[model samples]
Target: MGKVTAQTRLANQLLLEAIKNPKNLPVLSLADWELLIRMGRRTRLLGRLEADLSRIGLLAEIPSRAADHLRAARNVIDHRNTLVKWEINRILWALNGTEAPIILLKGAAYVQANLPPAHGRIFADVDLLRPEERIEEIEEKLSLRGWLKMQIDPYDDRYYRVWMHEIPPLRHRERGTEIDIHHRILPRTSRLNSDPALLFEAARPLEDSRLHVLAPADMVLHALVHLFLECDPREGLRLRDLLDVHLLFQHYGQEQSFWDGLTPRAYKLGLERPLFYGLRFALRFFDTPIPQTVRSEIKNAGPRWPMLWLMDHLVALAILPGHPDYPYPWATLARHLLYLRAHWLKMPPLMLARHLLYKAYLRSRGVRGKVDLAKLDLRQQ
Candidate 1:
């Protein structure tokens, strides 16, 4: 492991210890408290910290400034929850006549299912998945209901319609919340496009509505795939993503069936690699409890010797916080490698080359260097 800053240390300590045992928050110096707050904000863990601290009455002991941050984060989360309910209701109303099931994904699923991870989690969009054939009708209905499609160039539009997993993001003109409509769990161009029907078959409906969430095992797989293998690799480094994995383990791992089914389900999805990496880091970082037998099985199922060794080293650098210890030269290089690795895993070389070239061309033509997830209020995984 690389040397990490005291700030990262304090922040991580708070997260791990508090999640495991909320009553046992470590005592903090003023400087440590400041760093904890800063790191929490950067890693999207402030709301989580606030929730855990309050769970055991330690929220009051935090420094005033830190408490202020916690309060602000909680306020944002509460507001987001309110907006989420409104959005869900609107979605139900829009698709009322259709029999297509509106399956919520990611943060939306966490919130809808009342999962432990959703307690203080935030979301910028509501992700909806229906069977592939229903997508066009759903999009048309949403459009009729005042959700406008995000404007993109013709090429990018075609990229999404033909190649990507989801439709162009749609934002409600009145409510201003983006909703991603997906017909599949992953991009059509991705290397591992498992039969989406498998996922659909495992979904169970939420109470009193058409909204559905993936089964416990599928939910874990989705989170693992999202964090470790899909979307932005930098996002996997976020403490909140790690914490989500921890919470999933804490909540669902209590069921012996959850453990028994995990491996087989992951293989069925063609996602054993992501699950392996997810479990590896979740255990390493948070000491997530896994049955010894299951752990042994996963170890036996994991990547081969040198590949595992390389992933351990590279992942440690890529996922750990970058800063005073692991500076830009080294830490940033790890991020670059992992970022490209995500792209390589998603698309074939020829397609990836063309995509990167076109993106570079756009950057040269004064398009932003990259879309800032934070600025866009994106809550990926």
Candidate 2:
């Protein structure tokens, strides 16, 4: 690991403390407030910051400048969330006659369910999951409703169709809102055996809507899998995602059934390891209230001590924001390593090597407009 300057440590620590306890925030000096806002914004947690403070009634006491930044972040999320609901309504309208079930995923799920994690959450696009057999039908319906696949390299498109969990993203012609139609939680080629059938069987419906969401435990596991297994390192580790895990755990952990069922569900989906990592980090960063018995059971799913130790360091460096002007070299190294680790976890060795070589070849040839190659769904094309 590269050296971390005291300034960086202090900055990271302050941001973390504020997240853990927003009530302590009103005491921060102006200079500290500046650091907090920058780190929160970089981590996409500024709106979350606003939400947390407001939840605890501390938002009104925050310094005016900091509060302004927080409110602005919240406003952006509010607008995006409004658009998300409208998009989903339009999606339902488009698929009115179709009998296939559609389930909201990630940000859209959190919002529609009115989960705690959705409070002030910023969304870039909407995500949906449907049965694989109905994927083509869903895509067709959306296309007729003005949603079209994003143009990309033919190879990449083939990759998505062949190996990915979702098709190439679809964007509406009029609103320009993007939607990812997924058939499963993980890629078809991924090592984890996350069966969409299991998810669909357990999904719960929304009130006054045809759409559904994963059951509570499934929701938590999906968030963790996305956090620990499916992240694009180019985007860095989102502290916001970890915060989502924290909030999900916080809300769901209130029920004994949620705790009892979580680990078993993860095992059923071949996602125990991600569940372990999610719990470990959420506990570490947010002091999430997990039951001791649940903690003991999850321990069996963790990596060995040496591997766990190494992962702790790597995750800390990659997830915690450094100074926006001077990011730590070790943090960049950690992101790249995690990027490679994600691919290793997702693909078999031979296929991974081939896919990576092809991607490297494209980059070497000055492929500027290629989608973030790290995020591809590999294909023979």
Candidate 3:
């Protein structure tokens, strides 16, 4: 990581303090509030910050400018929430005749379930998990109704169909909303084995709707996998995503059953590692209220001290939001390393090397293939 300046350190501390303890925000001067707002906006946590403050009955206590920005973010989230609901309705309408079960994933699921993570969160598209065998049928049904495949390169399309967990995202021709259909959580070639069947079995249906969402424990597990495995650190550690996990834990951790089932469920689905990393970081950043016994149980799932020590440094640099005025060279390096680590975890050594070489060859020849799609949009994912 690049050399850290005192100002940058203060910026990081201020933002973390704002999120983790909004009750103390009233003591910050106007200048610090401005910096805090900028950091929150950059990290995509302004809405979450707003929600946190409102939950604690301290929204009106912050500086007026900061409050305005937070409220504005909440307004954007409200509009997107409505669009997501409509998109979900359209999807169900398009697939009206199908017998396949549809389960909502991620942000859309959080919204429909009235879960804590949905508060002040944005949604870019709908993600649905369905039976693997029925994928083509569902694809065809949606195609007939106007949702069409995103016009990505044919090679990338084949790669997704053959190796990836989800197909290339589909965009509606008229409405321009996107949808990602998945058969499983991780890619087919991933080392970890999180079965779609198990997710389906544990899913709970939404009230007065045909749709379902992963059970509370499963939902948290899925969020962990998505955060630790699927995300590209190059874009930013997506602190907002980590905050989602924090909020989910804070909401669901109230029940003894939720805590009892979480670790066992992770072990059953081969997601224990993600659980370990998720819990570790969530506690570090937000002091998420995980039980002491649960923490001890998850310790066995982590790497040895040497590797864990290295990962602690890498994740700290890569996951934390950087100051807008001063970017760190070391943080960029950490992000690149973690980016490769993400790809390595997704595919075995030989396949990953081949994939990287092929993508590199395309880059050398000025061929823009799937690499373009790899560029992340924080608002979207």
Deviation from native of the Cα of residue 99 in model 1, angstroms: 0.5
lDDT of 1 by residue, 131-245 (tens): 8898889999988887877756777888889988888898776677889998887788888767789888889989956888988888887887677655354443455777788
TM-score of each: 0.90, 0.94, 0.94
By lDDT, the better pick of 1 and 3 is: 3
- Candidate No. with top TM-score: 2
- Residue 372, model 2: Cα distance from true site in angstroms: 14
Say which candidate scores most in lDDT: 2
Look at candidate 2 and tell me the lDDT of residue 244.
91
Alpha carbon lDDT of each predicted model: 0.77, 0.86, 0.86
Q: After superposition on all CA atoms, how large is the RMSD of candidate 2?
A: 4.1
Q: Is candidate 1 or candidate 2 better by lDDT?
A: 2
Error at 312, model 1, angstroms:
1.5
Superposition TM-score, candidate 3 onto the true structure: 0.94
Question: Which residues of candidate 3, in runs, are more than 4 Å off?
Answer: 1-3, 370-381
Give the per-residue lDDT of model 2 (tens digit) for 1-381: 234566678788898999888889999999899888888887888998899899889998988989999999999999999999999999999999888667999999988889998997898899999999999899988987888667678878888999889899987776879999999988888988777899999999999458899999999889987887765666667788999999888898888999999989899998999999999999998899899998999899999989999999999988888776566888888888888888888879998999999888888997753454334442311
